[model samples]
Each structure stands twice: as structure tokens, then as C-alpha cells.
Target: MHHRATTSRRTLLTVTAAAAAAAATGATASAHAGASGDRRLHGLISRMSLEEKVGQLFVMRVYGHSATAPDQADADANLKEIGVRTAAELIARYHVGGIIYFSWAHNTREPHQIADLSNGIQRAGLDRPTPVPLLISIDQEHGIVARIGEPATLMPGAMALGAAGSRSDARRAARIAGSELAAMGIRQNYAPVADVNVNPANPVIGVRSFGADPQAVAGLVAAQVRGYQAAGVAATAKHFPGHGDTETDSHYGLPRIGHTRAQWEALDAPPFRAAVAAGIDSIMTAHIVVPALDAAEDPATLSRPILTGILRERLGYDGVVVTDSLGMEGVRTKYGDDRVPVLALKAGCDQLLNPPDLALAWNAVLRAVRSGEISEARLDESILRILRLKAKLGLFRDPYVSHEGVDRAVGTRSHLAAADRIAERTTTLLLNDGGLLPLDRRERPNLLVVGADPASPSGTTGPPTATLATALTELGFTVAALSTGTAPSAARIDEAVAASAGKDAIVVGTYNVSATSTQRTLVSRLAATGVPVVTVAIRNPYDVARLGGQRATLATYSWTDVELRAAARVIAGRARPEGRLPVPVQRADDPTRVLYPVGYGLTY
Candidate 1:
């Protein structure tokens, strides 16, 4: 977990590109020169025109598999809209200060390929007459919202780490995760979700958060920040003022957090305060509306009081105030794509992340600056914060990564082993009504593994992926497997139930059961078979509530291959279930009637 960071890809690119930059009279990555780096910052800002300065606030996305970002229409469509073809064009055209990569962008299996792509982006930024290396980043929040998967250590999620109940382990998990990004040349990580999942009915921030308790979430978030920052990656504590107590998904529509100022301070702001206290250099604003802080019905991402008054003045946090993706429906739809970026800047955000239309947003911000709607001083303040972060990251010294060391450094065996241990530790067995787990293979020798594959409706290609079925097989069981499609028909459930006929014991895996009634129904049907079953919620911990009359129930809170195998270990008795529930579990129809409250798990 304490592995040294590999050589930077930005450093490698610098040696080759510095000569050209020198010839053009532009500084290399090392633009900040002087004892205090003050003179250099002033010189750079002084030279920047209004357009260039405004451009520094936007952070554009470049997905891995696609030429256009995830939010964009298509490659040609993006070109027609923005007059830019690829990330390279977007960077040049807008002078984007940062680039965030999604799974589609950094989805390569090869570590070197990821490193090269990141290094290329940094090189592009450094080539201009006034050069500042890009803040290459990804939302690698492990578990649920992870971007870098497979080749990298798919570290157990924030809740899993909280379930493991060790701050040191939390730090270790984040460090392992950040090491991968650092090795791959991505210096900024938008992670350490600061939302405290107090509302059991909350849709989005469930397992992504640390826990239901404010104090515990604070400790966990602070620890993760330390771990990530120590590994030379800047960590951003996100969804500020809490995105936890909401029923709506910001990706789709507006979510209103209707807590009083006192309630908000008690439940949501504690974690954010702790994050800032721990020196979190960046905090991403949430899109949900915190009415107590701002009564205008504006989301936190565009609220002056929330971003500037609360986070900046009240909390006394001066680190970067980054807005959540501007493209999210929560804010983007409220103020058309072009207007959101400028509004975000005026609202006191330092970095505008993932604006839907890069050119339009850039032009809007530029216009705002030129028209004096956004002051020049305010522009400098935001860009200066960005430049200060780059300087702190030593991006000015050497911003690129070396491809040669990526294989050695990113997702090494040690990191993966640690991740596996963390996963195993967090695999919570909520129920074992009949000691049905640790299947006495000798007794339950004919093992039948079954579940609904998330991407198995016939046409999609999802990993042929590591399912609990494969995992049980690897544990030396005669695992006959049956996978129903995502939306299992009644017939399909009958078929699955039929498959469990001769099996001594059945292990059913549930994926995202909170939202999928089909998977929940399949579990109920399997229960009707009365095969002494054990249900594992592969994605949602709340799946137990969805399935009634289960012989036993377990929760892994993730579907990563490592977590699947970890669940296997727990089921096979190779490892004990050490995790406690991080969220409260209640009766299916009742939130007040708690069945298994926060910090509840069973082990033999």
C-alpha cells in the first residue's frame, strides 16, 4: 500500500517537448519559476488574455472508448457543435485547464496505454505559448462510482471500508487506489464522497457514502483524503452540503435537501467540515438544492450562499471549490448548457467540471468576463487556485508519466491482494437463518449458482464477467450455474427455479435489486423452491428487504471480480464475515421499523 509512485508520463513528455516549447518561447511544465512561485504565477496570469483566463475554469471530459465525451452526442456531432474533433482539439480551442477521464476514456487494458493518453493530454496543454499542464483526473471512487476497473485494484467501496471499521484500512484502500492513478499519470481524483447516507430511501448516495453516522463519515473521509493526498494525488471530497438526504437522482432531475440550517449543519456538513480540517485541497459541490442554505431553489453547484457563504466563509475552506458535472440534469437543464459554466464561476466555484458543451460554456464564461459580469479579479482568483494546485502537484516541475514503469507500479500483486482482503473483510452476511452458508460441500455437494446478470438481456457484452457462479466454482464446488437476464420473465424465473431442483443448496446473486423488481422476484421464486438458499446482494445491500422468506441473505455491495471472489471466501468459510452494515435495513414497507440498523452483520 505504501508503494512509491512510478515515474510520471508528464515527465517523460517534457524531455521531448520542452525543446519545442523553448523554441516557441513558451515555458515547459515548469512555468512557475521563483523562490515563492509568486513571480511566475503573476507573470503567467498577466500574459493571459480574458478568453484564456476564463477557459482555465472549465474541466472537459474525454471518455476512453469514444471520441466524444459521455455526455456528448457523437464525434461528428461534437465537432459540428464545437468545431473540435477530439480532446486535443477541445483543449486547444478552449484552453481547458483540466481534463477528467471516465471509464470510456481510460478503459484500456494496458497500463502503458492509459499513461500515454494522459501524458499526451498534458503535452498538449504545455505546448501553448502560455503553458499550464492539465489536471488529468478520474472519478475513481471505488465501488459503485468507479472509473478505473479491472487492471487497477478495484478497491472495496467507501461503505465497505467503513464496514471494515478501520480508519487505517480506509487509508490503505484509498492509497492503493490512488497509487494506480498516479502511476497512470492522473494526478487529481474526484473521490472520498463526503455524503453521510442517513436516508435509507436515498437513491444515489447509498453505498457510495461512508455510513449513516455523521461523525463516522467524517473520520472515514478525512482518512481517505490523507491516503490519497499522500500518494501524490489530489483528493476531492465531493457532493458538498451532502447529496445523501435526497430521493431524486441529480443525473436525472433536481433533488431538494429540505433540512433546516441546524439540521444541515448536524447531518451533512460535518463530513465536509472534517474533510476541510484534514486539508482536503478540493471539494466538489452537489447539484441538489439545500434550501436551508439557499432558498432560491438553486442547487449547491450554482448557489452563491452554499458555495461561497457556507463552504468558503462559514466553513473557512479555501481549497478548490469544484462544481459537480455541469452536464448533470440537475443544474444543466435549469440554466442551458452555455450559461451554467458562467453561473458556476459567479457562484464561487473554482473549477467547472464536465460542462455539456465545451465551446458554448467557454464562450459564455469569456463573454461574462468581457462584459464585466464576472470580474477580472474573480477570474484570477479561480485560475490562480487552479495554478496553485498544479504547482503543489509539481506538475510545473514534471507533469508527464513514464510508460515504462506503469506495468510495475499500477495495480501490482500486493495492491490487489490488499484489495481482496478488504473486499473479504467487508462482505457482510446479514442473515444465516439455518447456518446455510459455509455450505458443507460434503452435504450440499451439488452446488447451483444462479443470478440475474446485469448486462445479459441478449445483445449487451458485459465481461462474460466474473459472476458469483464462477467464483463458487473456483472454490472447488461442482457449481452448476443459471443466469437469468436483467429483466427475468416469469418463465425465466421458473426455468431458474427448475434448475435448482436437484441441487442440495442454491446461492443466488442479486444485482441492483433495489431498482430491479425482476431480480427481487427471482429471489422470491428461488426461495419458494425451498433449497436452503443463501442470497447475496452483489450490488445493493438493501436487496434483503426486496426478497422475502430467504433462507439466508448476504451483501457484497459491489460486483467487481475481486468482491465476488471475496464473497466466495465468506460463503466457503475460507474467510469469516467481518463487515457490519453501514446503513440501516428496515421492513420492506416501513422506514421506521428497523430490521437491521446501521452496524449490523452476522457471522458464525
Candidate 2:
């Protein structure tokens, strides 16, 4: 709707240098038409009021249905007048620049429902002063971090794709995932986790990362960026500097990385550099603290040395810098909810995401601006970066996507097949002693399948109908189902043991066994019986570390039904466990020696 000046020469070089670096790495940048729409972008920024410009720096979250009482009243009041809830109220009132879609917000099974909600939000943004379209973003990181579940394609996730051991797999995964997001009117993805999960005990980032190899992670990050952006969705390389080495979950508390500068450069920084080289649209800051980079104990999300000095200067990432969810305890605990947004902005983040209260955060930022704490010029810098990304997405031209083709485009047959391929590729076999795997279902069809219960899903997907038992049943195995809750209690373990008494073999599907003592105990209990026990880690790969006695141990890294089916095939000897270990698992007997080093996998 508005046009501005040509992009400065410095900006042009930033684009060219990124492209040149991609070419050197044998990766290609996404071919975006009208990339030179900066003139229009600048005009839009020039026309924006200071409040509007400041709003562009904060991206908040909104539920699809009214979750809270006040929000319900607001929606009902608006729905009465406009025949639809004015999603624009987020823009018209609070002036949040973007909105992150959670499963609750995009909860409907119908693709049209999700698309219509996105369109409504964007149309509302466009109707107000300056007429800028909102950035519809999601955690379509494909796998355990996915925000849009099925009917979207159920990707096997990062570790699975990484286990495939091919950049081609990474590229293809991102492309399919990105295309689906585009079909859903999602413009940005908080994905391509650049974190290298070096810690086996890491409960949060286990399967979210590609693998443990820094070089491989770098290559995969580049490949995924090319694929996702090429598919018309902006790909983010996140948890910058890195979140992989930390054991603490930032969602709950601050995790500090004590790596020296050199240590960080070696262990944590490679994938981020590679992502910048790949011309990634945005890089999400990690909430973890790197004492080597900034001695203040503040996270990269609130550190100038890390965000501006390291990422902006050393890494030459001139693109947008986005903060992780400001609402998380890692950030919120340090900086009060009202102050985190301003700190993130002052620290160099272009977007402050998921603040507790949008109005309070915006007012705080505005107050900082008025007090000369955050310069108006600096605020405009973030606005320009945000606008440039919006322009790259062509959000300015037309943000509304057609609902007619969305159902056909998202979660296509080809996408599902690609997901299956990756899942099969990433299904790693850590140990298969005594030739115990590929059990003949025809012979040992009387199997006890454990951990296939419908646990509360952490991601956006609705309660899954497909479980390990359901999948095993389809494979002609007489799977006796055991539905343990999120954690297997001692009673559940006893039940598993009793169930195993009559079964030919026990296939225990473990989740986060490293953290959940119940799961670890269940595995040890079953293995102690000396019965044929097979362990399959459906969430993280560290289960084998605790229950090394299992005759057959495997990891699928995610609970996507397709991946579960792939794991079943691997167990049945129909599909090979081609996936290698992405993160190292420590031996129970020896901490010095890794039980299974990275890239370890076995096949029948």
C-alpha cells in the first residue's frame, strides 16, 4: 500500500554477501521475487507513527478460541457487531506487530478454519492506519516442536531428519513443512533449531536439534533455510548462540553455559554462522546465559555483547534478531514481565515475542523511548528490519491466502510420504544384541506393546489416535496395549511386567527416560526379568543409556504416528534402522566413555 526509497548500498551488500557465502557452501539462497521491494517497505516505515513502529517490535500470542473470560467477552462483543471476531483488535488497540499461533489458536481440524483465522487477523491489521499486514508465525519446526499438527504433515522432526544423514533430507523436509505453513497463511517459522544438543540430559532440546555434529548441523541448517524460504515461508535458525549444551530448560529457569569464548566458538556457534551464511530470514535468541560472551549472567536474549557484538558484528547477521518467548521463566525471572520487552529491544532484538501483557510491554517500551533509554532511531532500526522481512514475504502486496486450495496444499500425500521417508531414515538402532530385532510377527505376534498410550501431547497436535500399539496392531502383531500416563508409575511398571509374562516379547515405548525415573525404572524392571525386552525411545534417545540391558534398543525421536509406524517396521525388519545417534548417550557404568557415540546406528 505504501512505497519508499531504494535500499541503501550497505543493505544491498548484506544480501549479496549472504548469497556468495551460500554459493561457496554449495547451497543456494531462496529465489524470492520482488526482493527489491525495500523501496515500498521504506515508504511504509516512513508513514508509520512512532507507536506503530514500536508495536512492530513486539510479537504477542493469541488463542484461537477465547481462552480467558475477558477475552471471551471481547470476542463475543466483537462477534456480535462484525459477524466475526475482529482479530484486528490486537493491532487496532495494542498494536502488536506479529502473532504466534499455538495449537489452541489454530486448533480446528479444517484447514479453512485455520486459514480463515489467519486471514481475519491479517485483514484486521491492514484495515488500520498505515495498513500493514501482520506477521502470522508458527513453531512449524516439524517434529516435537510443531505448532500445527495433523491435518498438517506430521514430519519426523529434526533428529530424525538429521539421522537420515543427508542435507537433501533436511532441505526436502523444510520445503514440505514450509509449503504447508504457506498454505495455512503462516509467513514465518520459528524453526531449523541451530542448537546442537551436546547434553544427553537436556530434557527440552533433545530431538529438536538436528544432531550432535556441528558441521553437519551447519550444513543441515543451511539446507533447511534454503528449502523453507524457497517454499515461501521464512525460516528461523533459533536459540542463538546455542541452547544445546545446557541441561536446564529455559521455559522453567535460566540455564547458564560456562563455555569459554573458544569453547563456544567450537561447540555452540557453528550452526548459527552457517545459518547466517544461508541467508536465513530471522534468528531467534536463546534465553540461556553464556558467561563467556557476557559476564552479566543475562541471556543472549538480553545481552548486547551476544546479540549485537557477536551475532551482529562477528557473525555479520544483518537480518532480523528475534527474542525467544519473553514470557518464559528464563527471561521473565531476570527481567520483570513489563521490562523484558524493552530490554530485548535495547539488547538488539527486532522482535519481542510472547510478553505476558502486550499493553504493559508496549507502554514500557514507549516509556523507555521517551526517557532516551531506547533511542527512537534504534527503535526505527528494528522497524526497518521487521518491514524488510514483511516485504520479503510479500505480505504488503496481499496477505490473505485462498481457503479453496489450502486443504489440498497442506499435508499432501507427497508431504506425508516425505515425512515417512525421513522418519524411516532417522529411526536409529542403538543396540540389537542376540539378533533379537526384526521379530517375526507371524511367529511372535503375541507382543506386549508398552508406552503407546495417548499422553498429553506437548505440541499443537490434538490427542493422537495413532499410538505404538495401534501401529503395531496394523503390522500384524498381536500388540497387547498398555496406556501409561505421561510418566510410568511403579504400578504401571508392575502391570508391564505382568503383561510381559504371557507375551512373546515386550516392546516398551519410553519417553524422556533420562528425566523420568519411572520410565527408567520400568525399563530396568522389564530387563531384570530376563524376558525378551525391546526398548524404543519415542521422545528422546537417552532411554537406551539408562536401560542398556534391553536386547533391542531404538529411538524414533518423536511420537508422530507415521514415525511410530516406521519404528514398528524397523522392529519388524521391514524398515532398516538407518538413523544414527544425533546426541551422545552416557553409559550408566561409565560416564567418561560414551555408550553410543554420535552417528551410531544398527540395522538388521
Candidate 3:
């Protein structure tokens, strides 16, 4: 595997001071390896062509498992968009500095497969005329947002860690995740979401955020940054200036956060400041418009005032500034695909991520530089930062990882046990009325596990119900599982109610109950069967407020197998419900009233 060489304490201290100085001065200074490294980086930059430097700023996505040998489906998609049949061809043509992996894109299949893919891509990048190492990155934020699934040491997500209320847990989980990603030859993790989820109604960032409190979220963000970097992976604090309070999903629409200047500073800026203070390797810009920060309708990704003025000047974060996907509607609504990238570069972004049409965006950037819209000097600033990061990651020294290390490090028994312990700590019992939980195994031997088996952000489903049943069965209960879909039809609810009959106790997993009445109806119908019912909010804690009448309720914050099994253990009295609510759940009937305040939890 690509191991980080140990640095002496004296050298580490000097490097830290240098990095702080670089951030304050906004200079593209190489701090990790001192003056010699700086000379080498500058020498490399001076020798690169404008085309090669421009390519270094883009971290594009390609549809393929292998660099040269893509499946038919991946080949068709790659050719249609990138004008290339394989990742190798695409890299040779565009000379992209980085590539992102997504399970949906078939980029991540298994640990060994991912390691091979990483090696292949790195080889392709090394074969380029200028020969730069590719930064292989993925959004393995765990919980609902994990791209690499199964046997990958899946840990509880940000909110779940928030609920667990332990910085050490957050740090440990991130360290394990980072080490695993590094083992698979992935160098960057777009994780430890720093967005403080103050808005419970936020559709995209609800469970992904650490919590609602800015200071608390800031603490966890810093801890996670330390953890990921400690494991030799670049940690990214994302959706900058904060995407926590917004209601719209940037993937579909441009959401405006109406926080005033003072409100923005107090409510949204703490986590970012904390991240900067922790020396986070990179910060990803949000696509949302905050009128207080910038008067223009442009998203933060395209706003010089936000990206340059606020982040660079005010926050003093000199590390790389990467834009969220340019294909997202939030960034695209204000400008064409061609103009968006140029605007982002001018706005102080160092990397452009996943543009919809790579050829169009790449050509646009090239034209901008040639037409004097974007200065070559300006391009060098980003290139220097990108290269400095690559060097710090030890990518220039050795980008390829050993395939044998994949099995040794990706999913070890010790790592999985740590995940289980962390997941167990995150199971928060919102309500356990009349001591209905810790269902007597002897009395409630025959149980029905039914409810919304919601698909995760990765598009994988069934851990909610299927995994719950398996966990309960392992705990010696005779369990029957019925998956009541997230938006269960009335017929599905009827089938669930029928399945609940004659059962000793009914266990229902609710997913985002506030969004749909059908799940609420399903839980209600199951409860009406006159059997003792236990509800687990497998996605978000807000669901508990909507189903207040339920006798027993727990919040897992995610539906991953780790979380579901944790919840099952809590139900079986194998583990205590130690987690507290990370964010408050307000009453559905009255927005002004708080139903379950933050830090609230029940234990028997």
C-alpha cells in the first residue's frame, strides 16, 4: 500500500507553522516538505503548458471500472459524453488531474476491483506527456452517502456520530474509513460533512451533517479532519459557507439561504473556521446563493465574493478550494456549461468537479485562457495548490497501491468490530413508553420486522428490514421480515398489517415519516393490530415527531446494515440506547414547538 513516510516532530511543527503562514498570506507555498519541495513544485509548474495546467484543475468523472477495458455499458456512456471509450483514453485526451468514483457509475465494484482501477488510472495519468499523478477520490462519507459498500468497514455517518456525542468516535471512524480508502488506492475522501444541519426539513443534508449546533459540528469537523489526514487521506469539509440550513437539494435546484451577514457569521461560519484551523486539506464550495455574502444570484461555487472574499480572506483557508459538481442545477441555472467553469476558476476555486459535458467545459476553459479571460498566472496559482496537495498526499512518490493490501486493510475484523461499537453507541431511543422495549425474548419470541426498507444514497436497499431480521434472528428470535417500501401503497400497508397479526411484537422501521403519510399510516395500522410495536427511525430522527403515538421508537440516523443491526441489538437489550438526539425534532403540528429537544434520549 501507499504508506505515508513518518515525519519528525520538529519537522511536523515547522511544517504546521509554514502552512498557517501560507494560509494567512494566500500564497501557493509548499509547506509539507519545506524549501526544497517548494523549489521542485515551482520548477514543475514553470515547465507545464497552459493546456496541461488547465487539465490539472479539473477532477472529472468517467464511466468505467478499468482504465482501458470498460464494460459495454460503461464504454457507451464514456464515449457519448467524454468522447472516449475508456478512462485511459479520456485522461490522455483531457489530461484530467483527478477522477471521482461512484458506485452508480460502476466505478467501484469491490475492494480488489477498485484497487486495480486506481492503479490503471494512475498508470494512464503517468503516461501523459507532462506525467502528473491522478487524485482518485470518492464520496465515502459512510452512512447514507457511501459509494463503496459491503466489506468496506461501513461506519455510522456524521449525524449518527453526532448523536453518539463523541469526538473520539468520529475520529476513530474517519481514521478507519480513510485507511480503507487508502488501501484501495483512493487518495481523497469527500467526507466528514461540516454542514451543521440546523434545518431539520433539509432534504439532502439531514442525516449527512454532524449536527445542528455550529460549535459542536465545528468540533467534530476538526476531529474528523485530523483523523482522515492522520490516515494519509485528504479530508474535505464540504458545501462551504454551509449547505445545512437550506431546503432545496442543489442537485436539482438553486436554494437561497437568507442568513444575514451577522446570522451567517454566527450560524454558518464556525464549522468552516474550525476546519481551516485544523488544517483541512480542501474545502468544497456550495452551489447555493447567500445574498448576505454575495449580492449576485450566482452560487458560492461561482461567487468570487464568497469563495475569494469570505473563504480566502476572512476565513484564511489557503488549502485547495474545489467546486461541487458543475452539473448540479444550482450552479448551472445561472450560467451555461461553458461559462460556469471559467466563473468558478475566477472565483478562486482550484478544482472543477464533475462537469456535465467534459469536452464542452474543457474547451471552454482552454478558450478562456487563450482569449485572456483567465490569466495564465491565475491558472498557475491553482496548479501550484493542486500539485502541493498531490505531493503532500505522497501521490507523486507512489500513486499505485498493492492489490494484496486491499484484503489486509480494506475490511479487517478489527475495523468491522469498531464500526459495530460505534453504531451501537448511535442508537438513540426517542421514546420507550411503558417500558415496551427490551422486548422479553421468551415472551416476544415470534416477531414481525416490517417497515420502509428505504434505498440509501448509494442506491442500495434492504438493510433496514432484511438486516434487522437477520440481526434479531442472530439474537435468537424467530423473525419474519416484510419490507414496507418508503412510500408504501395502501395495499402494501394492508399486507404489512396482515403480516403483523399473531406476532408477539411488531418492529417497524420508519424512513422520513414527515415526508409521507403512508409510512405513518403503515406504522399506525401495524400498531392497531393490538400487538406491542417498536419503531425505528432508520433514516432521520424527525420521523419520531410524526409518529408520537407509537409506544417505542428509536433513531438510527441511517439504514446501513451496521446501523440496523445496532438498532436490533438495542431492541434485544444487547446494547444500551446511549445516543442522544443530535438535532431537535419539532412537532409536526406546530413548528414553533419542540417535540424532542437536542440531547434527549431514553434508556431502560
What TM-score does model 2 achieve against the real structure?
A: 0.89
Q: If the candidates were sorted by their TM-score against the true structure, best first, what order would they fall in?
A: 3, 1, 2
**Which digits, one per residue and each the tens of the lDDT, describe model 3 over residues 93-199?**
88899999999889888889999999989877767656677898889999889899877889999999999989999999999999999999888889879898888
lDDT of candidate 1? 0.78
Compose the digit string of candidate 1's lDDT tens values, residues 1-604.
0111223334333432433232223234454333235445656778777777877888887644332242344455456655676666677778889888765544343567678777777766766546678888778888767666566677888888878878888999888888888888888999999998877677888888888889999999999999998888899998988998889999999998888999988899899999998888799999988778998878788889888888899999887989988888999757788778888888899999887777778888888888899999999999877877777776776777886667877778998899888888898989998677777667777877777566421111242223666767777778888777557889988888888888888887776666457877887778778787788887668778878767888887766677778888898888999999888877777767988888899898
TM-score winner among the candidates?
3
Name the runs in model 2 displaced over 4 angstroms: 1-36, 65-86, 106-109, 452-454, 458-466, 514-516, 524-531
Find the 10 residues in a row with the least total lDDT in model 3: 1-10
- The superposed Cα distance between candidate 2 and the true structure at residue 28, in angstroms, equals 13
How much is the lDDT of residue 86 in candidate 1? Answer: 68
- Pick by lDDT: 1 or 2, better one: 1
Off by over 4 Å in 3: 1-33, 457-463
Evaluate all candidate structures by whole-model CA lDDT and list the values in order. 0.78, 0.76, 0.86
Tens-place lDDT per residue, model 2, 1-604, is: 2122122222333333332232223124333322334444555567778888888887777655322222565466545532344455566776668878777553344567778777777756765666666787878776776666667786778888888888998898888878878887888999899998888777689888988889988999999999999988889999998998888999999998878999889978999989998889999998988888998978789999989999998989888888888878998878787778888887889988877666678889989998999888898888878877776676654567887669778878888887777778888998888899988987788888776444544432322323667777888888777766547777877887888886888888777654446776777788888778888887778777776568988888887777778988888888888888777777777778888888788887
RMSD of each: 6.1, 5.9, 4.9
Where in model 1 is the C-alpha error above 4 Å?
1-35, 63-78, 105-109, 455-466, 512-516
